[model samples]
Target: MLDQTIKVELSTTKKQKPNADQLQFGKIFTDHMFIMDYTEGKGWHDPRIVPYQPITLDPSSVVFHYGQTVFEGLKAYVTKEGKVQLFRPEKNMERLNQSNDRMVIPKIDEQFALKALKQLVSIDKDWIPTAEGTSLYIRPFIIATQPFLGVAPSSQYKFMIIMSPVGAYYKEGLNPVKILVENEYVRTVKGGTGTAKTGGNYAASLKAQEISSQKGYSQVLWLDGIEHKYVEEVGSMNIFFKIDGKVVTPELSGSILPGITRDSIIQLLKYWNIPVEERKISIEEIYEAYDKGLLEEAFGTGTAAVISPVGELLWKDRKIVLNNGETGPLSKKLYDTLTGIQYGTVEDPFGWIVTVE
Candidate 1:
């Protein structure tokens, strides 16, 4: 069993907090962070909150050599009443363990991890941004710390939770963004670490993302690695399409990261009586729908952007515009509802909010 008590140490000198309006994503960090260590025989031990500082690791750490790590992202929102709360943080802990399982890392106690996260957030509650579309981004990650030259899982590990006050993920905020369909460099295939939140999967996408940026695209739309025909997901988010008055997203085919926001949006749509489906969707099919004037809107969902409307999609030599290159009605509604619940303006009927007091 994991330790139930966590040690807290306040920072001696506080860092200057940035203006809420000037905040950028993943830039400014809080004063303190949460950390825990894991050993093969000892298991996880010494849960504590310490002053934010650099961590010293061996040069031959397993993470540097073999890239064995898993991470999760969520947010803490400050309501108008000045209460700090987290949105679906338990889901992030659950997903972290899922990623750990895939990466051959020891499992963490999910409830204890959530407890530690809540404590950390409570200590730095003031860091939660109050500006519109601003929140404290929480990153919980685990890394292999054992010093070894072998190509295997490390015997020691470190699980840490750090936070940063962030503004909107995209400069456009809720506005739509142009996406390029990547045909050459695939993100990942089945039976790979694509489903896991590991660094290697993202490192593989940098080349494609760099090429797409030069083409004036904000993100890349990835296809299945095997056939390279079916739509998988966006670079940083899961994708959804409004076709013929129905919502469609690609099914989890073991090559896609199961996003917590994506699942919530699907559930929200169903609650609102909107038609939604999850299946293998091809790029050709999307184009076919566009040709018939049935493609109405396209959007991406994740912890960062929440809902990123796709204004345009460029697949090969063909391109199609969605909803007149504006945010769609459904997309806006989803964004408003989700954010409202997050910021405590809207009633959370889904019980997704966890208050930190």
Candidate 2:
């Protein structure tokens, strides 16, 4: 547990808030942010809540050179009863620590970190957007600060949490998206930082993302690094496929992100008594399923989109359309149910909702 209480400092001058109806993703930030520092022997100390502003760092920081950084994303929703709540925030915290461990960064007190997050969210509670499908996005990240040119892990680090009020991730709401299977440029190998929420993994995906965007696809469905045949993940989310009335997703093969939303969907499917499988699923298998008319639906799961239904998938020159290029029934049901629980319109039977008091 964190023995130190977070010091609060309010901003004297606040920036003009954006129109909630016109809010975009990650474009605007809240008034205050939470910050904590870590030293080699001192561990983490001096937790504080201060006005959000520019941060200073040295040119030789390891985070810039060696990419010793990690981050987590979650959201705080404004319930129908005018109360602020969080959906599976502890999972994000736990994942953050997991990322930290993988990146050779120091571990954090998960509960205390959550408490700090709650305090920060409480301070910016008004920033939580109230529009339909709008919510306050929270970003917690850590960066190496040691101003040395060495390639080793930094002894100094800074952990910070920031908030952004955003609307829907996709402008078209829960509509389906077109995706391209990336045969070139592997995201990461099984022994790499693919399982970690680090910047380098995302940085390595920019080229493929640009190519996919130029090809008019919304995202790239990545294949396994070794064989380049098995489906690993989507651009930034976990991929799922519905074949012959059964739901299948790629298992956590140490190279795929273990997504919270993905886990929730699995549980939700099981709760509904639907067959869900997590194992190695190859692209050829998907095409075979399509050939047999068993490919029912496809979607991606992540914190940003929650669930992104796939309408079309292009692997090589062969293009396959799912659900007649419309959102599948199961996809719609999952989205509605997930969002309902998030916005407090549906009953949260799994105790996943955490109210921000």
TM-score of each: 0.98, 0.99
The C-alpha lDDT values of all candidates are 0.93, 0.94
Model 2 C-alpha lDDT per residue in residues 1-357, reported as the tens digit of each score: 466789999999887888867798898999999999999999999999999999999898888899999999999999878999899999999999999999999999999999999999999998998988889999999999999998898999999999999997766678899999999898998999999999999999999999999999989999999999999999999999999999999999999999999999999999999999999999999999999999999999988889999999999999999999998999889998998999999999999999989
Consecutive 10-residue window with the lowest summed lDDT within model 1: 167-176
How does model 1 score by TM-score? 0.98
Per-residue lDDT of model 1, residues 306-343, tens digit only: 99999999999998899999999999999999999999
Q: Which ten residues in a row have the lowest lDDT in candidate 2?
A: 167-176
Model 1 residue runs over 4 Å out of place are: 1-3, 170-173
Model 2: how far residue 5 lies from native, Å: 0.8
Clashing pairs in 2: none
Off by over 4 Å in 2: none
